[model samples]
Target: MNSFDKLYYENYHKVYRVALKMSGNAQNAMDIVQEVFLSLFDKLENGGEIIYPGTWLYKVTVNKCCDGLRKQMRFATLDVAAGNEFHEVTIEKQETRQIIEKALFELHPRERVIMVLYSEGFSYKEISEASGVKFQSVGKTISRILEKLEKKLKGLNNDLY
Candidate 1:
């Protein structure tokens, strides 16, 4: 197998999932993943030095995700807030997930990307590298985003009952 093929096999899912979480849609995630691979191929052909393909893939995926988010903002997101209430707690939990997801969508694209990457177990240093942000900025950004998500989720949970 070619180097690109091996890289694709090992990291495609990671790239796609990061894209999905950042973009907040499965379809957009798939598109971003394809775009990332295409860009990788182009770079390879141009003799670009890729010391760490995984990191490069993530950077490309994030850039595509941000691009998609910008395009999406031209249209309004679906009102996921409008829904029926459930008597069962489990069903209520599902609805809470939906609400939290909606709140996540409302975050700034960069904050959303940081939170999603951090959630996926990427280190602050790795997130810094992938996002092209300074190492010190990673901690502050992540802290702010996580705090925002927590507050939003708490409010959403209160509203659900």
Candidate 2:
């Protein structure tokens, strides 16, 4: 396989997982992944060079997910203004994954992205680069997010019990 094909193979799943965590929807994650790769392809086609493809992909994927969330919020706001009643879909009881996902879903988009990137084992520098957060603040921000997640998870567990 060619170099670009090799790069795509190496990073596709990583990018998809990040997108999925950031967007909280499989379909939206798939679309974001496609858009990210398409952007890389376009840049390469036009003679752009990427020194670190993995880092570049992570940044682009995060950006695309954030953009998608912003657009969704706009429409959701409009729907709310129209007096639409939103229904809460019941999830299966006691599923750990669902509970964690629910907690993560409650986080701000940026916080979610930071937590996802950190969980993926990226160093503080990588997280900062991908998330646009300052390097010095990554650890502190992570600590805050962890506290929020822990509290949210405890609350969810209490609800279940």
Candidate 3:
């Protein structure tokens, strides 16, 4: 297989999933995945160096997702607009999802990206590489971010029910 094909085979699934979780929607995730691969192909054709394919893919994915979120914040989010889609789920689970979505939307794009990466089980080093945050800061930053999520969730729960 060609190098681009090989890279696509190895990383496409992961890139799509990371985009999905980060954007909280299928369409946006797919768009980001497409853009990422297209950019990668362009870079490859232009003879740009790619020392670490996985890291580069993830970092680009994160940046694309962050850009989408920032633009989304300027308008509104898919989660907010699509709230009725969750009506078929159990109320408890739906409520939990709503609270989590609220918390995620409240976070700055950087924090949201880091939290998504952490939730996807990426190590601190991987998250730092993807996010450009310091490796030493990932733990402390994530700790604080989780605490913020928890606090927001608790507040949402109390306010809602």
Q: Per-residue CA lDDT of candidate 3, range 1-161, in tens? A: 99999999999999998888788777888999999999999999999999999999999999988888777665235445355676677777776777778778678889988988888899999999999999999999999998898888888787554
lDDT of each: 0.80, 0.80, 0.86
Q: Report lDDT (Cα) of residue 20, candidate 2.
A: 78
TM-scores for every candidate against the unseen true structure: 0.84, 0.81, 0.86
**Model 2, 19-76: lDDT tens per residue?**
8778766777788889999999888889999999988999999888877877777311
Number of the predicted model whose TM-score against the real structure is largest = 3
Per-residue lDDT of 56-160 in model 1, one digit per residue for the tens?
A: 888888888888778877423533433455444576677677877888888888777787788899998899988888998898887778788888877767775
Stretches of candidate 3 exceeding 4 Å from the true structure: 79-90, 159-161
Clash pairs, model 2 backbone: none
Q: Which stretches of candidate 2 lie over 4 Å from their true place?
A: 74-93, 159-161
**Candidate 2, backbone clash total:** 0
Segments of candidate 1 deviating more than 4 angstroms = 74-89, 154-161
Q: Candidate 2 — worst ten consecutive residues by lDDT sum? A: 75-84
